[model samples]
Every structure is written in C-alpha cells, then in structure tokens.
Target: MICKVAILLVVASVVLASPYNPYYQQQPYAFKYGVQDSYSGQNFGRKEISDGNVVKGTYSVDLPDGRQQTVDYQADKYSGFQAKVSYTGQYH
Candidate 1:
C-alpha cells in the first residue's frame, strides 16, 4: 500500500512565455496535515484549499478489515478533477 499526495507549485518561467500571459498571476493556498499511529497501524489525514481557480480536499484512511476510508475532493480548472468515496467501520 502506497499512498502519497503532494501539491506544491512555484513557477514564473520568464513570465510564462506568452500563452496569453498577461503578467502571470495565480497564487492562493491553504494547508493542513495529519498522521496517527497506534504502534505501526497507521492512520492518515489531509485537508486543503486553493484559490488559483478552485480546489478543495478531504482525506482519511484507517482500513485493514475494520473499515475507515474516506475521500472527498473537488477541483476546477474547468472541472478537471473530482473524487468521492466513503466507508466506515464494521465489515468483517
């Protein structure tokens, strides 16, 4: 099981080289992070926000027979990314 999520952006690249550049402005960010471990049984968490157009996030994990998996996500560079999944305990 490999789960890693990273979103970091920093670019100017000579004023973005004119794909309708118009002086290159798009920057907004918010962040949250979490982790929990009960002696090698790891838990997970995430939170996010952005205003470079639109972004939202939620993440969770704690599943290994006893369920606890959740994800809620949103994106808007004209509707490019989306996710919605959910689960909760007691499913042997």
Candidate 2:
C-alpha cells in the first residue's frame, strides 16, 4: 500500500508539472527572451506580440562601446515590416 501510494504521488506530480499536460496552458501571444555571453559585456532582452498575420516586437542590446541600441518593429500582411532603431549611453 505504501509503495502504491508513492507511485501515485509521483505520477500526480509529473502530470502537474508536464508542459504538454492539458491542465498546464501557456499564453498564445506572449513571449519573453534574453541573452548574454562573452561576445558582449551586457545582456540583451526582447519582447514580442503576434497573432496570425501581424507581429510586433522590441529589442534592446548593449553595444561594446558602452551604448545601448533599442529597436521597435512591426510587420503585417498589409504594411509589411517596419522598424525604428535608437541608441543611448556614452561612447568612447
């Protein structure tokens, strides 16, 4: 009986923690990401939103010269892709 109870608990935990489990659901239109490594001293982050036809997003990356560049973009079936990029911080 004790062994059976342990097995049941393990199964229950696995089901609850599974990414594909029906009880666990993720937002269809929401995402977040970040990256950092030796190539750049600072980290970069991006956020995005999208449906079937339209996509909009923004990203910020730190440059090697101590500046930060931020870009905002949008793309859709009608207008295509467009982006606006800006920079900030001190550069040697």
Candidate 3:
C-alpha cells in the first residue's frame, strides 16, 4: 500500500510540473536564429537578413522602469556579441 501511494504521488507531481515554454525565459536583449522558420520578436531587423542568414543588426529592449538596453548580434552564433545598457547616469 505504501509503495502504491508513493507511485501515485510521483505521477501526480510529474503531471503538475511546469510546462515547457521556450520563450518564457529568453533574454530581453538577445536574439537567436533558426529556432523557428522566421524571427518572432522585434529583437531582429529586416536589413540584417542576408543570404538566408542574419549578418548584423542592433537589438534593443526597454526595461520595466523605462531603462533601455541594446545588444548587437553579429555572425551566426553568440560570437562577437555586444551589449549596451543605458541608465540615468551613463551607458554601460
């Protein structure tokens, strides 16, 4: 009886686990390609599209408190990526 209850509890825990959502934890100023057939957010630019791939562009995001952060994605992967964060004091 104890073993059966434990098995049922394990099954119920697995069923109540969080659903898998890829976009739920994505970076605010980061862009990735090839996840889907086309880009899904404003993080990418049309001009950056070249030869069926992303070449160069700037990705910007506004924080909850009106702060802006921008990052530039170059090449294919995360290589040569630069991020710029703006605050009332200065840009970093």
Candidate 4:
C-alpha cells in the first residue's frame, strides 16, 4: 500500500510540474543594432523582439551590387521561421 501511495504522489507531482505550471514560463526580450562605416563600406543592422511564444525581427545588409537586402522574419514555438526577403536601390 505504501508503494502504491508513493507512486500516486509522484504522478501527481509530475502532472503539477508540467508546462501548465505557473512557474513554467519563458522571458521576453527585444533589441536593435546597426553599423555603418563609409571608409570600409560596411553597413548592416538588425532589430528583434520576442514575446516568449514568438519572435519577430528585421535585418538589412548592404549588397555589393549597389542594392540593399532586407529580410523580415517571424517564428513561433511550433511554426518555425518564416521570412520575406526584399531588395532596394539601383543595381550597378
């Protein structure tokens, strides 16, 4: 009987400590950055934010062909990352 009681208690604790538990949560964050140097022709930046369950961001880079490449992305716990890539400026 003691063995049965112990097993039941363990099972109850496991269920209580699952993802549904109030303490089982992730923190949210956000950030942005950039870089530009005319001397070296280096230019790139990124901005991102996460609300624990999903993440969203945008990043851009200076391309060698005189165009800028930008990417907007989103990702969720289950759906994986999705992005839209675009370019701007004249091509040489």
**Per-model TM values vs. the true structure:** 0.41, 0.60, 0.29, 0.73
Predicted candidate 2 versus true structure: per-residue lDDT over 65-91, tens digit per residue: 889999999987589999999999999
Best by TM-score: 4
Show model 4 residue runs off by greater than 4 Å. Answer: 1-24
Candidate scoring better on TM-score of 2 and 3: 2
* Superior by lDDT: candidate 2 or candidate 4: 4
What overall lDDT, based on C-alpha atoms, would model 4 receive against the true structure? 0.95
Q: In model 2, which regions exceed 4 Å deviation?
A: 1-28, 36-40
Error of 4 at 83 (Å): 0.5
State which candidate, 1 or 3, has the greater lDDT. Answer: 1
What is the lDDT, from 0 to 100, of the residue 17 in candidate 4? 72
CA RMSD per model (angstroms): 17.3, 10.7, 12.5, 4.5
RMSD of 1: 17.3
lDDT score for candidate 2 against the true structure? 0.86
* Tens digit per residue, CA lDDT, model 4, 4-30: 999999999999777665767878999
Candidate 3 lDDT over 1-92, as tens digits, reads: 99999999999898778575555653324334422223434332222333323356655554445455555445544454544443332343
- Poorest 10 consecutive residues of model 4 by lDDT? 17-26
lDDT of each: 0.81, 0.86, 0.48, 0.95
